[model samples]
Target: MLKPYQVYNTHSLSLCYNDYLLLQLLLCFWSSLFSLCLSLARNTKKILYLLQVAHKNSSMAKSICFCLQKLVFFILLSAIVSHARPPQVLPRQEPSYLKFVFNATDLPSEDYYDYIVVGGGTAGCPLAASLSHTFRVLLLERGGIAYGKANLMTQDGFLSTLVEVNAFDSPAQAFTSEDGVPNARGRVLGGSSAINAGFYSRADMDFYKNSGINWDLKLVNESYDWVERAIVFRPELKNWQSAVRDGLLEAGVDPYNGFSLDHIPGTKIGGSTFDSFGRRHSAADLLLYARAANIRVGVYASVERVLLASTTPFSGSRQSAIGVVFRDSNGRYHHAMVRRHGEVILSAGAIGSPQLLLLSGVGPRPQLSAWGIPVARHSPYVGQFLYDNPRNGISIVPSIPLEHSLIQVVGITEDGAYIEAASNIIPFASPARSVFIHTPSSPLYLTVATLMEKIVGPVSSGSLRLGSLDVRVNPIIRFNYFNNPVDVRRCVNGTRKLAGVLRSRSMEDFKFRDWFGNRDFRFVGPALPVNQTDEDQMADFCRRTVSTIWHYHGGCVVGKVVDGDFMVMGMNGLRVVDGSVFGVSPGTNPQATLMMMGRYVGMKIIRDRLRYS
Candidate 1:
C-alpha cells in the first residue's frame, strides 16, 4: 500500500511534468524570437551605416535612418509580444478520484467487486462512477489515462490526435471498414470522447420515444443536466463557424435557434466539451464525481473474456457470468469476480461490447463452434444491425484564411439532414517524401475547411464479425452505407442542402475568381454536383463520398441482444449499458446521449437494487 504522502508526491510529479513541457514551449518560442530580433538589428545597423556614409551631413538621410530604426524596433517589439505569448496552462489539479486508479500490472492476480464495469470510456467512466456511489466498483480500461496528455486535453490537438495511428499506444485506433472508408476509434481512457471533435448536443425527443427503454422523463432531464454541468460549455464562434451558421439560415435552414444544448430543427450553436481556454473535458473526467473509496480504475487492463459457470444443477448448459478474465499490459492475466448478487456490465461502446460478447461465447452458436469456443448462450444478434451514419460533404479551400475550429454550429434541416462545419489544419509530409509518411518533423501542412451533412436515423445497416481471434485486432465491420433507398434519399437531400449553403450570399466572400474571372468556391476534394436538382447525380455523389462521422451504433441492441433494462436476455448478472443499446444514433452527436446513458442506467440500477434489497 502506498503512503498518503507518497501518493501526493506522485501527483505532484505529474503536475510538474506538465509544467515542464509548458516551460519548454515558452523557451523555444523566446529563442526563435530572439534569433529573429538579432538578425533584424544587424540589417538595421547596416542600413543606417550606409545612409550615413552616402550623405555625410545630410539631415534628410539622418531623419530617414531614424524613422527606419524606430519602425523596425516597433515591429520587432510587437512581434515578440503578440506571437510569443505563452500557451494557456492546462488545469493543474488532477481529479481526486485518480488516487483510486491503478496500473493493471500493479493489481493482484484476483479480486472481487460488487460490479465490474468494462471499458472506461465515454459511457463506462460515468457508469462506474455512479455505481461507486452505492457499491464497490471496478472500472477496467484497455488504454492508459488521458489526464496528463496535452494532445488529448486541448482542442488544438484534436485533428493531430485523430491522425495519429500505426502505433499500438496511439489514442486513436485506425480501421478501414469493408466499404473501404477509413475510420478511427478511441483507444484511450475516455474512448472516442477524448479523441472526438467535442461537439455536445442532447438527443432529440424522437430518440427517447423510439428508444424502447422505460425512461423517467424527469430523471432523463436531470441526467443530462448532470453531464452538462460537469463537461459541456458554450462555444465562442469564430469567422468560419459564424459564416456557416448564417449561410445555413440564408439557405432556409430556419428560424435561428441561437445557442442551445437541446436538439431542435434549426441553425444553432451547440455546446462543446472544449472550454473557453480550449482544454477538453471528456467523459473520463466524470470520474471526479465518484466515491473514490468505492471505485477502483484499472488502466491497461484489456478484458479477454467474461468467465461463466453453470447456473443449473450441474447441467453445464445454463450459465451466468460470475467474473471476467483480463490481460494486463505485460500479458499476464487477472480475474475479477463479482460478489453475491453483483453484476458485470459491458459499457464498451457499440463495437467493443458486441465483440466481447462473441469472444465470451455469447454469440451465434455456429460462429463459436468455428472458433472452438464453448457456447454459453446463443445470441444471434450480438453483432448484427451495425450502423454508421454516412457523412457526405464537400471540403473547400477558403479564399481568406480562417481560424481553426471544430463542430460548433449545426444546421438541422427538416428534411432529416444535420449539417455541421469544421476547419482543421492538417499536417502532411513534404513533397520529397510519400504523403503516407506523416511525421511531426515534416513542415508541410494543409488547411481543410469543410461543410458536412449526415442523415438522421439511417435505415441502412450491416454487421460486425471477428477478424482475428486476438481481441486487440479490429473486427470486420461493414456498415453497408446507403444499402436502403430511404438512406440514399436522405443523403441526396442532405447533399442538396449543403449545395444550397454554398450558394448562399454569406459564402460569397469565401469564393475565389477563376482565370476567366468567374467567381467559384475552390474545392479541396470533390465539389458538389453542378446540377443539384438531379436526384440521380446527387444519389451517386452520396454513395461515392460516403464516410463515417463516427456516430456508429447498434449490435447488442435493446429488445434483441439485451432487454429494455439493458441486461442481456436469457442471462443473469450480465448487462450492456453503452451505445450498443442505441437503435439509432441520437441527435446530431451521440457523445452527449452516450454519456447520459451511463449516468441514467447506473442510477436505475442503484434504485432497483435498493428496492429489491
Candidate 2:
C-alpha cells in the first residue's frame, strides 16, 4: 500500500499536467491587475467631477455610469482572452441514473427473493437484470456505488483506478499472486467492465466446443445483439489503430476481416464498450433491461458464505442452499433467503466465486479440514485448474504523436495465440514547463505500441488456496505461467511475429523513436537480447517477464465444480456463473464472453424455474 504522500506523488505528474494548466495561467493576471488598478486611480478625480456635474441632471449621470461599466467589462474580457490556456478536453460527468440506485445500508423489508444473484458485476449485473423480468431478484455487490465517479471511469483515468491505494474504496482491487504477478479485479457494480480498456470481442468457436455444453448458437447470437444494443459500438479507427491494422496485414496475418464481433482468423476490427464521444458504458448500464419492480440491487454488501438447509431436498445429495450471509457497509450482517423453488447464483468473478464455495465448506475435504472449515461436501476441484491468459509483449515509444485508440485489430495465430496493439490518444500539455518557458506549444504525447499475446487455453495450470477461513482474507493465487513447454513455444513465436510486424516495410512511415534522444528505441517486456538465438533463453525470458492480459478463467470449471448447466456438482439450488465457470480462456478480452455467459445462465435459470414450478 502507498502512503498518502506517495499516492499524491504518483498521480501528481499526470494530474498536474491535466488539471493545473488553467490555474497557472490565472496566476499570471495577478501582477497585471495590480498595475491596472493604479492606472484607474489617476482617472478617479476626473471621473468623480464628471459624475457630480451629471448628478445635477439625472439622465446624463445614468448614461455615463452605464458607459463606464461596459468599458470596464470589455477590458477584463480582453485580458482573460489574451491569457487563455491551451485547449484541453474535460472528462465526462457521471451518468444521471444513480437516482434509482441504493446502498446496502438501506435494504428493503423483504428478506426473500425469487433469485439471489451475488456480485453485481459484469456477469452478475446482466444476470440479475435478465432474471428480474420473470422473478424477483436480489443483486449484491461488495464495492461502493460507482454512480458519481464518472470522470474516473469514462476518461483516461481508467488506468489510475486500477492502481488506487485504497483497495476497498476503489473500483479496482489490486493483488499479487504467490509467484509475484501483479493483477487487479473490479470491485464496483460494473465489475471489471468499469476498469478495463473496453475492447469487445467474442470467443473463438473452439472455446464453445471445448466447453462440452450444448449451446443454441442462434440464442447466443440473439444475446450478443441484446448486449450490443446497450453498450457496444464500432470504434472509429484513428491513426495508430489504422497503422496497426496495415502492419498486421503486411506481416501476413492475411485477409482483412473488417468490422465484426465474431473471432475470425486473420486481422479484424472489433467493437468497444466506449462510445464515439469517449464516454464509457459499463455492464451496469445493462441493468436497464431489468424489470425495476422485480429487481433490487444492494451495493457494498459483501457475501460471506452460502447458507445451506440442514437436510437435502433429495434423498442422497449435498445439502440444499437456501440463502446467503452477507455484511453491509455498517458492519451489520444479514441473511438473505430465496423463495421455494428459487435459486442462489454466485457471479462473484473467478476469484470471489471459488473462494465463496470453499468458505461455504463445499471444496476438497482435505483442504477444508486444513483451513479449519467444516466440510459440507467433498468436491475436490472447487479452486483448481485456474488459467490466466499470460501475455508477452513489446512497447515502442514513437517519435510521431499517436492518435488515441483502444484495441481494434487482432491477429489469430494457427497455434492458438492472439495478438493485438493499442495506444492512448488523450493529449497532454506540461503546465509547469509552459509557465516557465512562457510558451504554449503542444507537449509530447507518450504513444505506446504493444504486441500482446494470449494462449486460448494452455496445458499449464495453477491453483487458488484459502489463506484463512475468514471471508475478508483473500485467497492465495498462482498462475504458474508458461509451465507447459507448448505454451512457451507459442509465446516465443508470437513475440517474434510481433517484432517482425513492427519492422515491416508497411510501418516505415512512422518512426519508432524512443522518449530519450537515442537511436536505440525502447522495447518493453523481455526484449530479444542482441544476438541471443537460443530457444531456451527466449523461453526463460518469457517466463520471467510475462504478465496476464486480465482474461482469467476456470477455478470453478463447469465439468469440475459445476455441471453442464453451471449448477454446483453436489449442492442443490446453487449455481456459479461468471468467468470462474469458463472451462478455458476465451482467447481475447473476456468481457464479451463473460456477459454472454451471464445472459445464457439467466435465461437457463428462468426456463428451469418455470418448468419446476
Candidate 3:
C-alpha cells in the first residue's frame, strides 16, 4: 500500500499505458456502432410509416376509379335497350263478326273495279264468286281476317257456348236497360258466315206468296240446284239413328216434306248431292276462290258515309253511286269513286245495309227524324218487315247415342196444320270438355230443338242508327217472339209431349236437368216453365226468356224497302243481298236459303243488268 494519491495516479497511468492502440480503436468503433444502430432504427420506423401511407392512398384511388366505371356502364345500358321495339300495333278487342274469318290487304287508290260489293257475309260470299268471273268486282269488308286464329279456322270453339252470341265476351260495367242484351253484328271479313253451324232449309212458301212480293214456290224450286252446287248443302247423316229422331218417329212424325229431306234428298227423289257447308261449300272457301281468280277485296275499311254525286244522272234521281267515303285503320279518312262509271252493289247486309240507307236518307222518314238523323228522303219501308228464324227449343237427356253430334236428328210436321201438333225433332250436342273426354257413346246428355215456322214473329223492325258519325247506337227492336196463339199452343203441346218421353220408362237410363238444374224434368219435356193452365201465360214467358238465335232477317226486305231484284228501289246504283231479304223466317236452317239468294241474285245481276247496262 503506497500513499493513496500517488497510488491512484500510478494506477491511472498504468491503465492508460496497458490499453493498447487496437483496444482504443475498438472502443471508438463500438461507440460509432451504437450511434449508427440508433440512427438505423429511427430510419426504419420512418420508412415503414411512409409505406403504410402509400398503401392507403393507392387503395382509395382504386375504389374511386371503380365507382366511376359502374356509373358509366349503367347510363349506357339504359339508353341502348330503350330504342328497340316492333313497328306495327295490334287491336285490343276484336269485333263481334270476326267469327266470319275474313282478311284483306290494303286496297290501293289505283284499284278501279267496276262492281263494288259491300260486306263479305253468308250471301255476299257466293255472290262475289259468281260475278267476279265476268266483272272487275271489289268486295269491301269492315273487319279483319281469321286465317291464323285456330278457333275460327278449324271451328275448334264450341257451338253452344254463349261465345257464339252477339254479346261482348266481357261483362258490361253499367247496363243501359232492364234487358240490356248486347245484340251485335259479325265483324270479320266473311261476316257471320264463318261460325254458323250450316243448318239448311227454306221458310214457309206461304210467307213469300202472302207478302206483296211476286215470289212463288215455282221460282224458288227452279233455282234450288244452282244454289246447292255453290253452297254444297247435304245432310251429314243420311239414315239417322239419333234419340231425338227416334223419339219423333215413335210419335209418328214424318220427314219435313215442305221440301222433303231439305238436305240431300235421295237422287231417286230429287237426284242432287251436297257437302258439309249445308250443301257443298263454305262462304270463306268460295270467297277465297274468288280472290285466287284475281278479284280484288278490301277489309277493315269501315264505310263512314255514302258520298253521292253532286250531279244527277237519273230520271229525277241523282246518280245511284257517285263515290263511296270510307276510313282506314289509322283513323284516316279516304274515298273511292265508283270505277269509271262502274256501279256499286250495296250488300252491306241486314243491320249495316239498312243503317247505311237510313244514314244516307233512303228509309222511313219519321223514325229517322225521331232518332235525330237528318232525313235524305222519306222512303217509308226502309227498316220495315224484319224477319228471322223462329227458333223453338227444348232440352232432353237422351237414352240413346248417335254418331256426329251436329245435325244428329231431324223430324217434320206430319200434317199441313202443325199449329195443332208438335212434330219432328232435331238435336245438337255440346262439345266434349273436361279431362273426362266423354263421348256421345255415354248417352249421358242431349238437347233437342224444334222450330215454329208460322208464328207471331218480330213485330217491330229494329233500326241501326248512328249516335255520331263514328259511333253505332243501340238498335230499336220490338219483337213479340211467341205472340201468336198458334205459337203458344205449339210450345205447350211440344213441352208436355217431350216431358212425357223423359218420364217414360224407356228413357230411365238418362239423367236430366233444366232451369239451372233446380227441377229435374227427367226425360219428357218438363211442362213449360210458364203456368200451362192457359196459353197467354206461356206466351209471356216465351217473349221474356227468348233471345235471338241471331238469325235476323228482312229489316231491309228486298222488294219493299229495295226492289224485287234487291236493287235500292229509290237509288240508282245500289242493291241489297243477304238474309235480310226474307219477308218472314225461313222454316229451316237459313244457310241454304242465304246461299240460294246469293247465287240467284248474283246470276241475275250478271245476266240482265250488267249485260244490259
Candidate 4:
C-alpha cells in the first residue's frame, strides 16, 4: 500500500534526517502532480509540456550543476521523512500465549497475578486496562470479541445484536418473582455497553456528594475528567435542536449550550446536545491494547463466590474480600486464591453483583431464608435496595421515512434526548429528572420527547433475592414512581405537550393523520395523571408497559448494603464496583457512572493491594 512518495523515499536511504525530510516533500509534490495529470486524462504531450515548463524554471540558464544540487536535496528529504515513522513489525507468535510453569503447586497458578478483575465489560474493561500497567492484572470476561462481527458487533454506529441475545429472550421466558421484572441483562463480552444506544451523561452531582463518601461535585471534579480521559464517553444529549433549544429557553429550563453528535434520551431539560449517531464500541477493543502488554483475559467462566481463608468465620460478615471461586462452562469449579498480597473487585454489574453477594451468604434475612440458604453473616442491607431506570417507547408512524442509518444527527436543549425519525421516539430516562415534552413532524413516524424531573426518591425501596445459584428470583422492586404527585403531574403535562406538538406539525394540517395519528394513551388505570388524581391509570401504564433502560444501581450499595469504601458492609475481602451503588438513582443513564465507579474502586483496591505488597 505504499504511495509514490513512500516508494521514492524508500530509495533515498543514505540521507540525514533533514535531507531525507526534504526529499520526501519533493517526492510528494511530484506524486501529486502526476496523479492530478493522470486523473485529468492528460495526454503524453501535455504531460511532457508540464514537465518541460518545470524543467525550464529549474534550469536557471541551462545550468546542470544547479539541477544536480536540487535532485540531491530531494533524495535527502525523502530519506529523513521515511525514517521518522516507526518500522512496522512483522507478525510473530504472541507473547501472552507463553506458559510460565513456576507455581509448583496448584496455588491458582502463578497466574497468582497481583490483580484479577472479573468482567471486562464496561467499567471492568477500562479499569483493567488502566491498572494492568501497574501490576500483573487478569481481566475475566464471558463474551466474544466485541467488534469485527458484522452481525453481532458492527463498526457502524448502530445497536448491536448483543443486547437482544440475553440469557432469556422474552419476559415470560426470563425468570421473575412476584414483582415480574424480566431480567434482561446482556451476557455479551461488552456487556450492556456493547448493545446500548451510545447514550452518555452524568447524574446529579449532589446525589454522589451526599452519599456517605462525602464526595461533592467540586471534590469529585477530577474524577469526572479522569473518566472522560479514560474513555470517549460524552453526554447523551451532546447537541440540541433549534425548536427544542428555543422551547427550553422559553420555558426557563436551559442548562448550557454546548452541543454533541449522538442522542441519548432524557439528557436535556437544560444542557448540551445529545449524541446523534450513537457511540457503539466493544470493551474487547479497548482492553486488547492492554492485552498486547502482557495483560490476560478469561471468558465463559461463571464466578460463583469469593474464596476467603476462614473456615472458622465466613468472610462476607467480617473483613475484606480476598479472592474468588468460579465454575467453568464444563461444570468444573476452581478457586483463584488471593490469600494475601492483593485484592478482589466485584465488577459483576448491578443485577449480577447483588446476586453474587446474596449467593456468598451476605444479604437480608427473609429473602435468604426463603431460598434455604444459610446466612453466613446477616447484613440486613444486602440486596435490599434494587433499582433500575424504567423505559417506554412512544411510537408515531411518521409521514416521512425512517431510515435506521448510521452517522446519525441529533439536537439538544432544555428537554431530553430526541431522535430525528418521523414516526418513532426512543428516549432513555428515569422519573428522577421529571422531564418531558413532544415535537411532531409529518408523522409517518412519531416524535416523542421529554422534560424530566428528579424522580428516584428514597421512599421507594426494593430488594434482590436469589432463587438458585444460576437464577435471581423476582426482585422485589417498589419504585413508588407515581407516589410523587408532582411526578405524576409532570407526566400528565408531558403528555399534553406531546399532544400539542402533534397538533401543530404538518401531519395534522396536511391531513397525514391516517398514518401518523396515534390513539392517545388513555386506558383503564388508576395512576393516570387525570388531574394527577387518577393514580390507577398512570400506574397501569407504568406497570404493564414500561421496560427498563437497564440503568440499575444501588441494590448492593456502599453505605446501605456495602461499606463506605465499597466492601460489602459485612463482607471480608469482597467489593462490589458496578452501577449498583448509586445510593439514589441519578435520573440519567448509568453507563458513565458505572464506569466511574469501576475505575474508582479498581484503583482503590489496587492501592490497598500495593500497600500490602
The whole-model C-alpha lDDT of candidate 1 against the native structure comes to 0.82
Looking at model 3, report the run of 10 residues with the lowest lDDT sum.
Answer: 6-15
Give the number of the best model, judged by TM-score.
1
Candidate closer to the true structure by lDDT (higher is better), 1 or 2: 1
Q: How close is candidate 4 to the true structure, as a TM-score?
A: 0.63
lDDT of 3 at 94: 32
Predictions in order: lDDT: 0.82, 0.74, 0.48, 0.46
TM-score for all predictions?
0.84, 0.82, 0.64, 0.63
- Candidate 4, position 101, lDDT: 11
Stretches of candidate 1 above 4 Å error? 2-92, 312-316, 427-445
User: How do the residues 1-613 of candidate 3 rate in per-residue lDDT, one tens digit apiece?
Assistant: 1111100111010001112332353344335545645665778876567556758797755554454343433233222212221112121233222222222324554446667777766777677767787777767767655444333432212132214333222111111212333344566555665554444455555556654456545646655665555444334343222334444445545443332435321111111122433221346456644534436556666775665553553456434665676666666665666665566666666667777777776677777787677765677877666553234444432322322223333343422212111211211222253122256332112222222222323343443433444423434553344445565555555444444333444334333322233334322232355445565665554554444556667767756777776766766677778766666655445656676666666667676756777
Cα lDDT tens digits for candidate 4, 426-503: 222222431221223111111222222222332345666665666323344444333445444444444433333333
User: Candidate 2, residues 234-349: lDDT per residue as tens digits?
Assistant: 98887667887888888877678899898888888899998876667888888888887788788888889999875544546458889999887788888899988788999999
Ranking by TM-score: 1, 2, 3, 4
Looking at model 2, residue 266 earns an lDDT score of 83
Q: What pairs collide in candidate 1?
A: none
